[model samples]
Target: MRKEIFSKKIMDWYQANHRNLPWRKTTEPYKIWLSEIILQQTRVAQGLPYYERFVGAFPDVLDLAKAPVQKVLRLWQGLGYYTRARNLHRCAKLVVRDFEGHFPNSFEGLKKLPGIGPYTAAAIASIAFREPVGVVDGNVFRVLARIFGIDKDIASDAGKKYFFSLANELLDEAHPDIFNQAVMEFGALHCLPKNPKCDGCTFSKQCEANQKDLQSLLPVKHKKLKIRTRYFYYFIVRDKNKMLLKQRNGKDIWQGLYDFYLIETSRRKKTAEVVKTDAILTKASILKESRVFRHLLSHQKLLVKFVELKLHSTKEMNLLARRSELKKFTKPEISNLPKPILIDRYLKANP
Candidate 1:
């Protein structure tokens, strides 16, 4: 009975009112998986162009798998959360090698992929394969909590478990694709984070949040973020017209992106400390001017200090010659070449 109502109302609404997204037109699991990954830390508006770009560049799993990691990273530049790109590349290769360039159809099989967790696996399984699995993303969580009047803190482990169980129970097996899309679409379009359109909402009649005048309070989440400040001194070394850049090597942010040679300190360092740091500047033969900038992340505050060094010769520094030459190097280029951001900023400020 409940299933019938859910199907009749939500599925009907979905068929008539679903947004015209590119990924919705096909049941290609690879494409769906790619969209899901790209849309994870990104919004629909921002991710759509990147999705189109990736699809155009590598039309198939085999193409994505065969492409170099650097090429993939270059395409994924400015998207942030670069580990997602790395994992996607790794997963693509694994799919090609083991699954013959086909995305795994089963939830367990999908889970075995490099970056796919339960939510992603369930999303691909249900949407791509019409499995009975339910996708409980942030949108679904909000909609469910409001509809069911669940007041548990969504951030807690117990609350999440309860929500997952409830979602599984509410999932309509007959039309998993339409059901999944409908719920997510409803939340995204109507049951939003703020000022939900309860008047137009299909579930407004029975929505506990609306009835209790607690629409904004239904999806309870307590954020506990530990924000840390980091100071980075980037050395932009140049010889003649070419500037020096280097690939970031670590398990932190901008892992595959390009940056200048960095000298990180516990606290913000002065110009004297930056100039006198012999160990840090040993790589560069000559020193020019130091410029400073700041780039912020979700939980990180980066105080970027740029020190432009004029190299005696390009022979020892292993740097790119011209701006055009920097285009040829990708993620792997990080290992051998320097980044453009550091050089661009240095030239902009100094020259």
Candidate 2:
């Protein structure tokens, strides 16, 4: 029954070539969920070490639930998308408080938790608990779309539904755990988005897209991303060896993460233009107007410029400081503080 549509050769390839990751070795649902969350917006190579660190530090779901939010955010620093970390912490607490520190055994139950969406729940349910469900992440979507020559825009709801139905048909329920993993791994390693090695691929002969020479063009997306351009003016205000660091609050990226004094503008402003509007810049000594750092987000392009300001006295710095907007961190303390990648880059180079 399993052999009708499911590929046995892909399982063989998975057994032979799958990376020996730490999370894969564990049968614990907590560890599996942790790995999935870390790898959500992250890559395998970059996420592996963070996974190991998290597993070691928390050790159990109970530990993670009891740990401070700051501690969790610090551990998750530099991972980007701080919301994942926050939700992970929140989910842990909910599990502890509601479910008695046990993850939900079923996909629907898992989705009720803070950050466990359909893809994540499916991965955890099938891989950890042997539930008969298939994951349809970006990798899985790519694999199914290419092998079956599916030309529908995968980003659409209809396309996702069609692919999920096809995936359900191909899933070997008796071996759901290995089947889902194999399909995702096949996409990640062999049925690549770019230049896939179709000549050596096990499914090359049977693959529809490969036969049609349309692997690169098959998995289409309907909506073009609307990338907005933003300008940020960062003031690195320093009084002696102490500098101001502020925690990002409100509905914005890098919440719970620390960064320097920030002033966001609709358009990039020249130093002369910025100085005329603000009296502080006219009084404070502008050390250097650093080079513009271009940062690319999923839907935004940020052009950032850093200006270092040195005050004459401690009183002068204190007078200008907005306690709500700033907190002073010593030179040594700055190194210990976790910051966004943009700020971190500037610190390392300048120091």
Candidate 3:
């Protein structure tokens, strides 16, 4: 198909059927950048509220830069991939300190910001600054691969470059922003990964995958993620209204988040085995043991168990805290600290 025809059809479809997202209504680079980052690896339905909350709390780059990282993380509690929240704060600070609170106007300049990669930079450039660049995301990759019958593995660097080049070639330079939004929207709404609506599609006849009955086969991704199983035994040492909590400082999952005293093992252990493994656990009075909680991440499966312990004396509490290298936090204070979703869920369930 002709490049102009392809872009025109996409734009027409988008004009008729596009969802009215708030970010699409503005040309502000800051808002656009925030929306782009929030929507990364996140669906519109789930990410919309977060975007709104962030905008409400930190209205601009300067506000975000000035806000404390813990406050930012608290706002971003349930949203997994905590690194995004950290980077969002870092990016805001960089824009304020280095760029004078103004987001760079060009793609190259935007790329220098933290968490703004090629796709994000292109999105900010085209949508906010009217830079003629193509935005290649998962939706775009699937749409282009099926329509063009290109079976390159989307996970590979070569496949990414190929699709990006194709998107740029088909870009409507005069209205690159609209064109990019249209194609991405079309891919999201129509050309789905499973059960795509091809009967009423604009390019059903010309779509290579549709004609060849290879809809499920195109947009091939060869990489298979290896899942690792971990066992986490949490000691919830509590006194009256406060609990002992520790901040994760290691280069591991849930960094910068608060949780209880953790004893990770190669295999799941019973309460007795856990108690025998630690001197503090042996001395502390066991209040209750939680049922095993199974949590799954992108590549990690966790079998988590919580052992609640109560201290009868302040001396015992202090000793437990000192031995475990944990600090006491009241319920109100614990509520404000950022924590892993598993920790949050366990707290809510136990409380």
Predicted candidate 1 versus true structure: per-residue lDDT over 251-296, tens digit per residue: 9877766765566889987855765765435545445445456766
Off by over 4 Å in 2: 1-5, 225-351
Q: State the local distance difference test value for candidate 3.
A: 0.91
If candidate 3 were superposed on the true structure by all CA atoms, what would the RMSD be? 14.9
What are the per-residue Cα lDDT tens digits for candidate 2 across 206-256? 788889999888688787879999988888888777898898879988888
* lDDT of candidate 3 over 1-351, digit per residue (tens): 889889888899999999999999899999999999998999999999999999999989899999999999999889788999999999999989988999999899999888999999999999999999999999999999998899998998899899999999999999989999998898889999999999989998889999999998988999788999999999888788888999998889999999999999998768888788877678778888889999999999999999888767778888878887899999999999999999999989878
> What TM-score quantifies how close candidate 3 is to the native fold?
0.67
**lDDT-better candidate, 1 vs 2:** 2
Against the correct fold, how does model 2 do in TM-score? 0.67
Range of the 10 consecutive residues with the lowest summed lDDT in candidate 3: 276-285
Instruction: Return the clash pairs for model 3, or none.
Output: none
**lDDT per model, in order?**
0.78, 0.86, 0.91
**Residue 293's C-alpha lDDT in candidate 1?**
64
